[model samples]
Target: MPVRTADAALAGVRRGVGAERLTGRTALVTGSSRGMGRAAAIRLAQEGALVAVHYNRDEAAAREVVTSVEKDGGRAFAVRGELGVDGDVDGLFAVLEEDLRERTGSTDLHILVNNAGVMGGVGADEVTPEQFDRIFAVNAKAPFFLIQRALRNMPDGGRIINISSGLTRFANPDEIAYAMSKGALEQLALHFAKALGPRRITINSVAPGITRNGNPVFDIPEVVEQMAGLSAFGRVGEPEDVADVVAFLATDEARWITGSFVDATGGTLLG
Candidate 1:
């Protein structure tokens, strides 16, 4: 079988012609220039949400996402900010708010997806203090503060979704640092769900396992088949597989669901 791209995974979903469940709402998805973030941004836009595509440095790729959204009659623009750095969250919202206000006459964000993360591929012994710090800073600290800042303008009935990892539940020695970072991320949803409940703003964490993310390894059939076996369905998880779940959480129908860690891992390691 041939390798499948993210777009191919979304082929079945009707774009520019759907329920428009998120009409008039505004969403910001970080690290959306590629992979699952890109898929979520598109999926939300398909449901009629004006999306802000955030990227660290890939302006060209970000533009491509914006273009793709606009081509389908959806509204989208790109914003850039490197996570894990001082003033990263502040700088990101500065641009995001300005663009939002200019377009909709309001700075209220309806959905926030904390998806940008770094995977420090090092075992426990080989991982350095600096490596651990950076990983936590990006995967944990940044999302924590991003939510803090987003609350300033996020209206009641808003949605906040953080992209976690299956490594938190399963074990991967080489990804110990990365998994720990995601574990910290999961804690955010657990506590915030209660805190934000009164305001009707839902917060949840989504954990995906062994997803195909445009990595060259996925291009090789042998590697693909081996990884496919990890899933109960005998297939690798697609970006859309995870994005569809994020999109559902952002809808009004999910108002009662909060502070949950959704397993988007395709039942990985369920044997």
Candidate 2:
């Protein structure tokens, strides 16, 4: 069955659901200048949450997202910081704090979406120490520390959503390092879920399949067709496809779901 829109499903919720479902809520989405991060940030703002759009080096793209969010009657701001640096995580949160205070009069962060990642194409034999370190630094280390920082401002019922890749399950030889990093993130999700369970905070990972988000991986027509065929749905995944799942997980509707890896991979792993 298809899910109904807020307007069609619950008239009462649409009529007077004060931003509590997301109104006063604040969210931080890293790598949100484009792709999955951009989609997720916009979706969160549409649902009433104030958004903090974080980008690594794309100031213009980040600002564009913030502008789009604001144009839609949502509140958003952009922050720049490299993931995995010692003070970078702190700087990102510091900006988040400032944005939250300016928008909601509080520094309380309610949602943290660790969506920044890099794919390493090095095979096992070609994988360099630097390549491995770089992938893990962004995919694993940055998210772990960001979670630690998010927890300080996140009270009970806070949400932490991590983005992983379906490569972790298929384990392609070319993306060993990237897969490994994502696999570690899945494990981190489980651990954080257990650690934060007592406080009612939810931590989960969303693994995407071969999503054609203007990434170089899908540049070749043959490769794109192969990826489309890999999914049981017979199509490549879209950013909005994954964004919808992320938005669902952020809602009160997903209160019972946590410590889990929800495969938003369009049935790519089924075959």
lDDT of 2 by residue, 1-271 (tens): 2222112332333222234467778899999999999989988988888888999898999999999988868788998889866787888878778878877889999999999999887779999998899899999999999999889999899999999999888869999889999999999889989999999899999999877677686767677767677777666887777887898888888889899999988888685
Off by over 4 Å in 1: 1-16
Window of ten residues with lowest summed lDDT in model 1: 1-10
Candidate 2 has its poorest 10 consecutive residues by lDDT at 1-10
Residue 7 shift from truth in candidate 2, angstroms: 21
Residues 67-149, model 1: lDDT tens digits: 99999888999999999999999999999999999999999999999999999878799999999999999999999999999
On lDDT, the candidate that comes out on top is 1
Cα misplacement distance, residue 84 of candidate 1 (Å) = 0.4
Candidate 1 to truth, TM = 0.95
Estimate candidate 2's alpha-carbon lDDT, on a 0 to 1 scale.
0.85
